[model samples]
Target: MAKAKPNNKVDPNKYLKNKDIEPEGKLGVAAAVGRMGLMLVGIVGIATEFFRDDGWLKAALGKLFESTSSMMLIPVIIFVLWLLNRWMSSESKSETKKSGDIPMYAMMAVGAYYLFKLITTGSL
Candidate 1:
């Protein structure tokens, strides 16, 4: 009688090669979504500045500032980013961060561009 072949196939372990690696599941999806949101907000801010005026962006930001204390905004953003980074890289065996952190980098770039636009327009 012929022996039946074992059928369960396992994916190659990514952690084996890279000691510190980011996963490609819900964590990646969440990070991508966050980055996309930030990018969209930046695009809208710039569009408002060009199409309408800086008042819309300023009003939107003003409302945000009014609701939350100015001191907490920067700290909260930093904490959130740090938390996400830690959570995403928690599976890695080493302390070193892996490359290909695209979403995070893109989000940061968008934030910088948005701030530059606001500053240049004297909106902030």
Candidate 2:
């Protein structure tokens, strides 16, 4: 009796149909950029405080929050970024694009407001 050869090849159509597989390249790059930006911000802020002559602890805390509005804005920025990332990483093809894209636009509006405020008042 002859031995049957085992199937070693995966069907491309079936592989593509599997929703569990995430598309590569751009997804990883976006995550890397976000992480690097956060690290760079932290490093700059820490270096600034370390090089200053004033009381580091109090000044660092004060500069971190700045004010109630600034403190609130921090979480909102984080949430918006996370939401956008999740939406981008979703593998669902049937999802309607228009239903969940509002956060980015809303963030843009908030960003514009902050930029205008900074320009006019010289402070955020």
Candidate 2 least-lDDT 10 residues: 38-47
Q: Enumerate clash totals for all models, in the order shown.
A: 0, 0
Q: Return the lDDT, model 2, position 90.
A: 44
Q: lDDT: which candidate is best?
A: 1
lDDT of all the models against the reference?
0.69, 0.64
User: What's model 2's overall lDDT?
Assistant: 0.64
lDDT per residue for candidate 1 within 36-97, as digits (tens), equals 76677666665766456546667766766886577478788889998877756746576545
Please give the lDDT score at residue 70 for candidate 1.
74
- lDDT by residue (tens digit), candidate 2, 1-124: 9999998998778756677876769979997665555445445444555567675767766776888766777778889988877776546867656646565455445555555655689754
